[model samples]
Target: MTDTSDQLPVPQRIPSGIAGLDRILHGGFLKGGSYLIMGPPGAGKTILGNQLCFNNVAAGGRAIYLTLLAETNSRMLANIQNFSYFTLTPIADTLSYLSGYSVLEQEGLEGLTALLRSEVRSHRATLLVIDGIVTAEQAAPTVQEWKKFLYDLNVAAEILGCATFLLMQFEEGPASQPEQTMADGLIELKVRSVNMRSIRELQVRKFRGSAFLEGGHNFAITQEGIVVHPRAEAVLAVSPAELPKPLATTEQPMRMGVGITHLDEMLRGGLPSSSTTLLLGASGTGKTLLGCHFLTQGIMQGQKALYFGFNETPAQLMRKMTRFNLDASRFVAAGQLELLWQPPVQDLLDVLAERLLNAIQRLRVKCLFIDGIGGFQRTMASTERLDLFLTALFTALRTLDITTVCSVELPDLFSPTVTLPQTISGTTAMVENILLLRYVELHSQLYRLISIMKMRESGYDPAIREFRITDHGIEVASTFASAEAILTGIARFSTVTPGVPPAFETSARPLQEQQS
Candidate 1:
């Protein structure tokens, strides 16, 4: 065996060519360090290895991808060509593939080692990737021979100044004998199905020379290739330019008409532009109706809008809204409104974010509404995952300066109110405004109430307004006066002393009493 440490000193950091992944490694991979990538079938282990080599070659460095299990070079080239960095001649020159299946199947470790050594020198390879170590191991007649082969391969990689990558498929337990011990670094790719949706995660089990980002991180497989999300950097210092400037007290208020004049007046115009608003209420509280009105108004003003409905199908939602006299078909036919009715099994937040991005790009969407958050939460088994998804979604949407409205369901109005579940509190806390809708009882009758809970950038009436869902959609009646505990979804008449007469008293009782 050769002295591995004395072979070649580590080179400077090499770019992974993946933006987010590079950040996780604090820059990029160690230039000349050999690493092991272990995962199950279809974990994207080979694709990641190919991406590393492709990135290096694209940046003027030489790389070689040696395959052991498969010899489909043409298919590999075609698959990789989809990426923006892929080039035919340059890639062919800089990147070469030597298959071990041919040599190992024909002769053994002696022939395999001979072929690898020849390719290492002839190709002038700087980066060496072993497609499947299992194939090489299976070809070896004995365990001792397999160990010797890996040791020789490592020594060859060291002497040649090539950064090596060994691909291994691991089962439930740890990797078998010499393979795990011989590797300098280890990365495990895990794909788990959570709530019937597949989530890809990556864990750096070991890194010899440098520290790595601890724990697993979310990743996605896009048409471009595998993209990993980098760990969020902490903000320490901020310049004066980074600090938000105070808004002028006399700034003109921008409005988004809700397609109802009375509702607009109640909102002192309508919803604000470039802000996140939440419509909170229980079932039958006109939350969907309000969101529909917002989208319809945006369409009328020539600004496109997108509505993401998780609970109801598009047809069902349209039919229901028609009963309230909202003609959504006009906006739909005009291509100004995009309605996305997704099943609860789907990741609604991801779908919503994707559609929002597309709409903003194609239609210059000014308003985006996620009809109800409850349906989204029900699909996600864990609150932490839901929160993480929403945080990423909201951050992306907020950066586009798109007016966003998220409707949330209230199971019990009297329950201690929270903007969102504990898992997603970080997301809900960032919302700029909240519109609270509730059903109240007054004079033995149930009446609908609307109150602005919070508005960050604009002034809004604090008083609760009486509203009803009618044939013309939601219309605000007169503002309630001398009312206390209105937010509790209940109201009572103010007490009058013996000598004092009541300001207003109806001889007829309300609908609640009639129903009773």
Candidate 2:
């Protein structure tokens, strides 16, 4: 037999234990490499170092943390006390922290390099973190000497199969540093203020052995250390699973009801299943009510459902359901239905998407109702990411076969300018269906009109209908074809009667009698 013992084992990764961060790092830091973490003061560098040490120990690996700057040990440990990863451990066997300022003072850079090598080998450490690396740079006699010290430390680390991090303080400024090119990976953290709101972001400039997400991802230093939220477009660039196959019929796929009897007929059966639908309307146009009906109908049909809203709390929503005789609290309590309500406040876009997707999977949901998608736009720090964000979000929804309905509030109650609303224009092309609800002026009175604007693939009735929200939920009446320019929300009829209703408004008017 041939000798087969010469093969080397493949290197593994060291997880940071920060939620949603490993994905951005492309499965965390690769073992046997050195990384540089640069940021200003109070940017969570110390928190990250301790968090990584505890994570490595929890994974059955040893770690050594060396600090060169001046700080009391109690104050450093105080910041990491709240997180679960900061549990006390046997210092000799697991995680060990020691001050290296004396070694660097007495013997200089060469002595520090030897000290790091000695400590790592003695502890059998798989992970190492050198906090306050800038002190070493300032102590070096020359820039070339600093670079040499880094090269020696990195080589020793790789040979010993240990992943290393050098934490350095840096003010927000330009990049062109000498040490940046020498490290195997470089990560930068920043806190920027936009419109009086602070946004914390992380960016990975370079990685040697892995391909990482390239963008400024949002991060927060909560009680659980540092939690990063990767950009949605980058993380979900491709759908997690394949989308459902199309139906055999020509342009006709599966259809699900919109909860109203006559509206389903107007929809030529119902909205397309596993499709994204947008409800375009202004405030008080029954958008939330219509979404409630959609979720109620799905729950009644024994399909799991989710209602994610920013404006309404669970108590408020349950009260509205009671008004329509649709009691959903029972299903909600049974875990068949879930209500995910985030208050209208500043939030990370990718964080919301993470919660949305996780809830869908938790409930095995089939129908989804987003009460006000424009709420997300209002809370976002960057407006340019709207198009790509929604496209990726809806693509992931389709991959899970979720029939989604989103309510978008138009700026005006009635207008004829033919302009897309700034909040929703980026999402029009991403959805499969569009339904319009607007107030049309007729006979000195405002009447609401509902119409199907577009059905991308399915065939449907294009007639404009008058819809009413009564004590019995949404009721769709006959088509309002007697007036021209009804779509403009300023209807014009040939009849001159001011008080009397038009003939088309009469309930006795036959559906066949209306304009085809």
Candidate 3:
């Protein structure tokens, strides 16, 4: 039989040399296709185009960078000199930089197309970058002439087996542009001002034959070039079945102790490895202390841990933990723990997620603690993305088999509601366990109460227990036998019939007996 597979030619792709951008493109740009890069004057379109050219030439492909703007070649080269990727010698030999301004002025669109064709063929270039299409549009007296020029340019590129990038100053949206219709792909870069701060974003408006991540991803202009950070919500790769096997012994299912004896008894032993728990409470309700206990437990067990303190500085966290007799400094000094403290305001969610994932992989961390999840919501531009972002993050941690504890603060300190705050609603569905800490007022005295609200695939104590932060550490009492409505912030005893036992009698036992 004839081999029909040989009749189909292999598809070709060109790497943009930007890791995140390539990922957003679902691989890379299709080879031998024309793409349009549009943005405002200072949106880094020219820089992106040039960076692609340099990266392609470095990969054994010749490229031409032709500019039709008033900016001179020397000025452009000098501007790019500071970038790490801008190499002088290789750019001089392999890549060609030519000015199309004079040609467009002398012979109009026809001469510009002819010049592009001549240079692409003479240099045997596989990539061509036209850096000033807006100027070319100004030169075209009629719309038909502009369309003809674009058609000619595309035909020339296809015939010569060259991939073309047309960079233009797009002041407005490109929804109605005829040039957009002709190009095989369109990439848009934008700089938006929010509360007096600039945020750079990139979007793939069109990729004719390929599926790309369809969203505005955050990007930044660094010393190297434009680096894109894809939104975590758009990319969900984590799942329990895909989790890496535990690095330690595989003889039994791994579990991490919660560090509190009574809490462990309530949890039936401890949290399962790779599970995520959310500690929901109000301010000054021992959430941070609980997270410290979890991390300290992991460190004591010889497992690496990471702590992302969203609101507290490292020193502040150390001082606070010291009050509870937990010394995080020693573990940090020994490199068994990583403590990162970034102010939540003006922060990008994707950037934080990236840093967290990188730390988990680099440290091979098995335990993670995020203090101030309520403050984490302040970092996002919109509250709607918080759920998706947290879901993706927890999934990624689960895939790495990292047990995590995140603390979220409620709005009303005295309210008895157990739901998440408005800013971070719907995140409870992603959590494998939920612990609620609340303030209780009994007999004109303020006390702390703890409850295991929910536990997936496991049984937990259903009674509300009173806890105290002593000089040594947190001490958990058995269920509050003296109160009936302790969780409502107002505690009182329930009346009972003379012949029957009180309701609190069976609901709680002594701490010593419960632990045993």
Tell me the spans in candidate 3 whose CA falls farther than 4 Å from its real position. 1-4, 171-176, 237-254, 482-516
Maximum-TM-score candidate? 2
Provide TM-scores for the models.
0.66, 0.90, 0.87
What would the per-residue lDDT of candidate 3 be over residues 63-154, giving only the tens digit for each residue?
Answer: 99999988999999999889888998777778999999999999999999989999999999989999988899999999999999999998
Q: Which ten residues in a row have the lowest lDDT in candidate 3?
A: 507-516
Which is better, 1 or 3, measured by lDDT?
A: 3
Give the 10-residue window scoring lowest on summed lDDT in candidate 2: 507-516
Residue pairs of candidate 1 with colliding backbone atoms: none
lDDT of 1 by residue, 286-385 (tens): 8888898888887777788888878889898778767766677777887887788777565433334444456677877788889877666665435566
Report every candidate's CA lDDT. 0.71, 0.81, 0.82
TM-score result, candidate 3: 0.87
A best-first ranking of the candidates according to their TM-score comes to 2, 3, 1
Q: Which has the higher TM-score value, candidate number 1 or candidate number 3?
A: 3
Task: Encode model 2's per-residue lDDT on 1-516: one tens digit a residue.
Answer: 756787666658888777577988878898989999988888888988888898888888999989998985667777678886778764656888888899999999999999999999999999999999999999999989998999998999999989999999865565656678889999988888999988999999898988889988999988778889998889778743466666776556778788888788888878888999999888888898899888878887778999999998989988888887677788788887788898877788888888888888888999999988877787689877877888888888888788999998888877854356675677898899999988665445566678888898787888878765656677676555532344443544333244332344433222222221
Model 2 pairs whose backbones collide: none
